[model samples]
Target: MSLPKELHSSKFEQYMESIKIMYLIDDRFKMICDQYCISKIKAERNKQKSEKYLYQQLENENLSQELEEEILFYIIKNM
Candidate 1:
């Protein structure tokens, strides 16, 4: 089986964007990845790979708010 070129290209680009955005949003993510022996490269890559899928699924404004709350809840809970 083979994927279309455009689909493969877009998926690759999204992965790059996610890694770059995560780095910009929090340098600590990079540090944590390193300190814990996480693959900084793979961490950035997976984050990038999932960014587009995540955004597309959460595009509804009302739902985004709800999702934000959920994320915040988890953050606070962990803290």
Candidate 2:
């Protein structure tokens, strides 16, 4: 199967294969992956914003970390 576009250059790069497998077989995992991607994109955009948007960047970072942890947990559990 082709690599998921969302997994490219992500923090979970090392877990690409596992993620691809889970993403296909597990709908919840897919949603988490999509959310993670969206969070990363928002964080990147927030970086270009003014200081007023600092909180948004921080929120996105936190969400990203939480999602990463959840993904890792799922992978480990399934493995």
Candidate 3:
């Protein structure tokens, strides 16, 4: 899949591999946004701006192993 120029580097490929795994779990970006209490517009904005943060959260973070859990925290108690 083609990505933004900024995401065309080798490190991006590594991240993309991990990103692909996340997508495999649930590619429904819309659903993910809803579950995460995030707006569609906000998600789109984060596509570029939050790539680094997302990569970190997805790859190294221990709080949530699955992207779904990481996204839609069951204990948030608020959306």
Model 3 TM? 0.20
**Residue range 1-79, candidate 3, lDDT tens digits:** 3323443356557677655555456558435534544453467788867897887876766644575685668557466
Task: Say which candidate scores most in TM-score.
Answer: 2
TM per prediction: 0.26, 0.50, 0.20
In candidate 3, position 57 carries an lDDT of: 76
In model 1, what is the error at residue 41, expressed in angstroms? 54
lDDT per residue (tens digit) for residues 35-66 in model 2 = 88789778877776756578788989999999
Per-prediction backbone clash count: 2, 0, 0
> Where does candidate 3 stray beyond 4 Å?
1-11, 27-79
Off by over 4 Å in 2: 1-6, 51-79
| Top model number, lDDT | 2
Quantify all predictions' global Cα lDDT against the true fold: 0.61, 0.81, 0.56
On lDDT, the stronger of 1 and 3 is 1
lDDT (Cα, tens digit) per residue for candidate 1, span 1-79: 2222232344457675555566457778555534534454567779987997688776776688999999999999999
Clashing pairs for model 3 are none
